[model samples]
Target: MLYSMSFPLSHNDKNKYRYSHHNGDSTCKGIDVHEIFMTKSRVRLLLSHIGILVCLVNCYISLVKDKLCSSSIWKITVIILFAKFMQYKPVKKESLVILPEFGLQLETHYWSGKIARRFVPGGKILRPVLNECVTPFTCYWSLALILHGEDQLMLVFQELKPPLKLLVPIWKALRSSFDVKEGSSA
Candidate 1:
């Protein structure tokens, strides 16, 4: 993107005083004027260029070994261009705290990793009626656990609920019913 600084001056004293500020364009609108004008050492720019060249060389060598040099080259080129474009672009930060908690803490004491709770016996007795409500929530929890960086073993154990384990056939039947309903609606 081109950098152009606009100066707002009165017609009477256009040449007498000069002011420099951002020339807000479609691409550079969000960038701070100070950051764009800040000077960097020549060595930094040279090192960045060398780093990109090294990555490209590695990609090319890997592509040649795979016998997909042409397609891989195109993909790598696009990826590099995209990275450059994003580096130049200013973006707003996203918040991790905004993720939906989905009533995880409120539902059952066992879910919160509380060991003292007698949830297992209750779960075994409540398996039949609770399967419908539990399956969707169980699936949702397993997915959320994965998203929250839990280990694979924890994810497996968390999903091994009495209802979820016993009601696999019932869940499949429900899924088929939904597909039939969707077909009819369409």
Candidate 2:
């Protein structure tokens, strides 16, 4: 183990997190040979479509809120797309439930999960990972939004009825897990 000696680095691991390395970053911990080029995980598989949908929703909500008193906003597409591509099933468009104390929770016959992302105080944070049944990576529920007040939550729920219903529970759970204050927000 001297400067004169050499070493060999081999990807004997099948884990996508272990195969590819991104400059000492944990985000690239799992990068399989096949996955390195194009990672098709549940979360990232359809990010392109999700990003577009998020943008469109934001634009629509902004326009409506500008002209009107206020508007409801929902990101059901995130879960629907998540379920369709990741879960291989149709998500219940109307069954989203919100528990202010609990944050947001996605529950159904086919699958159940939360729209959450655990918080990290500082340091290097890895890329977000999509959560399925078995494997949940770091910051699993990274999409949960923290509402400052109850009125804010109600107003949001008004515009978008489907998925925001669950945002509360997801946020609550995440907050509890991360030791966030009840009235605090991200």
Candidate 3:
């Protein structure tokens, strides 16, 4: 009998070493969309979320630590907004591609006409679509914060949460009235 050990590295130890070596600059740049799409485990999803949370933390840190002036901060925020919007665009397209590919992959792998029966909605579809639809409002809220300062920003941010709930309706009404009044006067 022969025993073979691969890499002589325990999984936990390898993970620890990998993480310790990353200095926050190691982003999700190299992650394969197909791998994420194929992963059905909640733990993997949670880990992905954790990575995004880390990036958000880094963004907050840079915003604070740079001690940027108000105007410069606003500009930086706009740039970040654009980057986020663009990042989601490719994801959205990939998601659209995946829906049809999923059917094909399932058909080829299972060799059954019942393959479609096993289909479940995937995050690849939901996340990108939701993000695309929400991007404008997201940009709006962030820009509002940059323009109006933290106190007002908090109020607006809370309103923009979801489904246009909370203060958004009232805010929009006020904005429309304000615009109407301006047009009438002009």
Candidate 4:
């Protein structure tokens, strides 16, 4: 069976966020796929295009009006800053594919149609952890893997940090797959 759900990232966010789970079938035995997608906002995409167009027009006018004047240099610098600010995120979605009898596959999909994937064998995965990451200005929840013989935790969703509400179900599913006992962090 395939289960899918979607909601806003936040009250003020205009972007659509969704996740889906696909249960394994006979073709791919014992495989479970969990995916989270972030759709780009049309308004934001339009604004970014307009901003880039305006920046290019201004840059050409400034360069033509004064070849090497200080004013032209300043104008170019401002245009570059604006272009950087208007840049859109490259990642489109991320997925976790669990093969209970084999291992886990982490997949990242980019807006440029590129997919980056990594695999970890079932034996190498010590545990699935839910971490509270604290930054100077804010805090967020993250899902990670405690791998055998590895010092650093492997983050499941590298580019997109979905909320705890989204991470809990995945965490539970992972724990169940690994047969992890509750109240034990061994």
Candidate 5:
């Protein structure tokens, strides 16, 4: 059986994000898996590229029309670089594959078709925790793992930060898979 849930994007967001849970099957050799996909809109991508092009064109026009000095040229270059940096998102998806008797697999899928995975054995999983992170501008929640030997907690989702509502189910599933009781360490 498969279970899925999608959260509507806020007014300011252009991309759609959702996460799904897939039950494991012995016959197919599939393990219980939960995946969060970051879907990019083609129109949005096109528009962003167009905006960057327009910025470059305007910069060129300014140089020709105003005979800008080196300082102004440097300013234009900085703006273009900042714009490119802000628009770059390489992660396509992130997943948590549950291996019942073994451990959990954390997978990160990149836009360039690269898959990076990390495995944490069941014995090493001290517990699953939900953390509320506060920033000066915004607040967010994150799911993390407390490994037996690791001093620092490992974040479940590295690139794509899913909201608290989407993270709860995964946190519970992880707890259950590791046979951990509420408010108790493994």
Candidate 6:
């Protein structure tokens, strides 16, 4: 896939600009002045290039060792590219938290090591439909104790309960903790 970007001609200019494209004729669009603001950085551009290379390598490896079909290879490549370059993050874990007190706390985690914590003060847990993961890849989902900052984090969700309306945003943020860091696997 080819990527292109547009930039304003200058601070004083608005409509006139130029676009750079990897392949094909790049055309600049004339939108209202400052309709949307976009900024690019060298690090992000470099990472995008690296992401493409990784996708290619992964596709080749899957094709060689796994003997995956060409279509599957393409699918995997697309997934990797979309994941890495397009900044689409995979949901790592979702959970309902049970605090020590009578109330409860909800937590969400991402592979990027960012934790989303939601606290419901004095929120009583009537009952917990606790589902435990006995082994790795159980139910195609495994539970492993991994150290997260100061806490040992669980990779699987054990409790079943939807957070309250106020906590929904917190859950959403926790689910989206995919903010890629300098050296994250996400």
TM-scores of the models, in the order given: 0.22, 0.18, 0.20, 0.79, 0.78, 0.24
lDDT of 1 by residue, 1-186 (tens): 433433443453343222122333685443222111112335645666676676677677767776776777677777677546433211111101110111111111122244321111211111111222246334421211211232332121232222232223323332242232433421
Q: 62-148, model 4: which lDDT tens digit per residue?
A: 988798599899999999999999977778999999989888999999989999999999999999999999999889899999999
Task: State the C-alpha lDDT per candidate.
Answer: 0.31, 0.30, 0.29, 0.88, 0.83, 0.39
Off by over 4 Å in 1: 1-36, 69-186
Q: What TM-score should be assigned to candidate 1? A: 0.22
Q: How many backbone overlaps does candidate 3 show?
A: 0
Model 4 clash count equals 0
Q: Per-residue CA lDDT of candidate 2, range 19-138, in tens?
A: 111121255332211101111246543665566566667566655666533332234444345445443222212122323233333322212332222222212211111122224542
lDDT tens digits, residue span 27-144, model 3: 5322111200121335645665665565566567767877676765775676566545433111110111123223101111111222222222222221111111246444322112
* lDDT head-to-head 1 vs 6, winner: 6
Count clashes in each candidate, considering only residues at least 3 apart in sequence or on different chains. 0, 25, 0, 0, 0, 0
lDDT leaderboard ranking: 4, 5, 6, 1, 2, 3
Q: Supply the TM-score for candidate 5.
A: 0.78
lDDT value, residue 66 of candidate 6: 75
Best by lDDT: 4
For residues 1-186, could you state the per-residue lDDT of candidate 6 as single tens digits?
233344434452233222222222335221101111123245655776777777777777777787797777677967675756555232344544332333334455554578676654332222222123345533222232232232434332332221122123323333233222434342
Between prediction 3 and prediction 5, the one with superior lDDT is 5
- What's the alpha carbon RMSD for model 6? 20.2
Better of 5 and 6 by TM-score: 5
Residue lDDT tens for model 5, 1-186: 788866665644324677888987667354789998888667766777777777788788878876898877886888688668647476889999988788889999998999999998888988999999899989888999999988999999989888776788899888888788866745
Error of 4 at 177 (Å): 1.2
In model 6, the number of clashes is 0
User: What ranking emerges by TM-score with the best candidate at the front?
Assistant: 4, 5, 6, 1, 3, 2
TM-score of the candidate numbered 2? 0.18
Residue 82's C-alpha lDDT in candidate 4?
96
